[model samples]
Target: MDQAVLPLSPTEQETSLGSIVPPHTADAYWLTPYGAPGAWSTNTTYIVGHSWEGRASPFNNISSLSQPGDVLTVTTAEGPVHYKIDRVTTEYKDTLKDSAIWDKAPGRLVLITCFMEDLGGKNIIIQASPLPAA
Candidate 1:
């Protein structure tokens, strides 16, 4: 896949991270180590995107997809990964949803982006879980 949409390798960023590590990307998808890709345990995996209202990026509309039970697909080197939207909410930058963001079961995904309405203060979060084997 082209990194123009995501990074091929982790690009270094001057950031302060408490867990695993932040994914590298100038304008691509970030796969944080909050949870292992295939690990379906109580550890939450976090993927984040930049919320550019008019920018052409996958996460640009992260805030606008406000329907529950929707599906989000991620194509990786291994194969396609699928998850179903379980929750979506706006959380103040100060008051984050602990249970929703961390210590999650395996096969779960957490997507975060800057809140367009909050002027970069709050975050729009999306939570999804793996689909049942078909």
Candidate 2:
């Protein structure tokens, strides 16, 4: 049977993994699908993303989050959050402000990382939406 072709939108994106800990607290990092493991917290710099081009640039766009086939977990002050891979892409340092990528969806988690230095300092973005309650 032929599959239905659906137009790709920024909402249908993938998720990325990230380690978030309470600021100015102790060595504590939030894990995915699970709470803080015993003493697993450290000044790990909350591994967000690396230099996409090994150059000085602001890594703060959610457009790349619209890529498909990516996964990520979000740990917020509320509790452990999970997201599935939907989309992935790389964008220039200038056009990062395009809110359409993020605003497309609500209560979604986005991961922005730096891709290898080359494609005009592009950023590796992973966008994911919240999973259903257990």
Candidate 3:
């Protein structure tokens, strides 16, 4: 919960080539060019990181976010934004871009990481929506 969210921007070359890879770091990365967290925009904000085996990383815990009502918060410069887990599903690495997680939605969040158990085959995707203020 105390993790940092670093901005990740694809290089112009990578962007032009249509290839983008998240950096190899333990911190969560906010995919730039999309709506930032807590924004009232028309794009889904994506936070991605690696899930390593035998290592205690925050992203490794993403696989446990299976319950629909679970909540997680992302702290931005403005403040904290809360999201409620809508669904958690996995997609093949080859077909991930075409998955439902890429849908354009206002105030939606999608956390992505490699599925450790099936590291080479699929990716773990945790989709959530902004939680209303109490």
Candidate 4:
């Protein structure tokens, strides 16, 4: 469950690349131009990674064990941000760009990873919102 979050490469950031094939690493990559945690109060923050089949990986548990109401913590330089899972679902790869994942929601956290069981055709998407301040 512990993995580093890497920033996109300069080329990736400049191009705003959104690839289904994740970087060749076990860590997650922050989606560029989307703003980092707490950088914007109303922009969705996307973190993408890979789900390896037949092997343990950082994102593997997201699809296999995550559930609604679960707490997802994102560590940032400023501090940690906590999100309460709202849903977990899968979408066919070809149509994901047009799906509801791109909706503009304030302080939304979205995690994207390949669906290990259907790597060639599907993606697992987890959506959550910032935990209300205590």
- Per-candidate TM-scores read 0.69, 0.45, 0.87, 0.86
Compare candidates 1 and 3 on lDDT and give the better one.
3
Q: Candidate 3 — worst ten consecutive residues by lDDT sum?
A: 14-23
User: What lDDT is reached at residue 62 by model 1?
Assistant: 64
Per-residue lDDT of model 4, residues 2-87, tens digit only:
77888764355433433445576778998766756653566788888888877777888677688999988888887888888899
Off by over 4 Å in 2: 1-48, 52-70, 102-104
Q: Model 3: per-residue lDDT, tens digit, 1-134?
A: 46788889978885455335688667788889777888475789988888778877778867774667898888776778889988888888877756767668989998888898886778888888998755
lDDT of each: 0.59, 0.39, 0.79, 0.79
Candidate 4 stretches greater than 4 Å from native: 9-20
Cα lDDT tens digits for candidate 1, 45-116: 566656555555555556676557887776656666777888888877655644347554677877777777
Best candidate according to TM-score: 3
Local lDDT at 71 for model 3: 87
Better of 2 and 3 by lDDT: 3
Better of 1 and 4 by TM-score: 4
Query: Model 2, 1-134: lDDT tens per residue?
Result: 11111111122121221122123321222213321211222211122333333344334333432446444454445655555656666665555555345343444545545555444455565555556645
Badly placed stretches (over 4 Å) of model 3 are 12-19
Would you list the clashing residue pairs of candidate 3? none
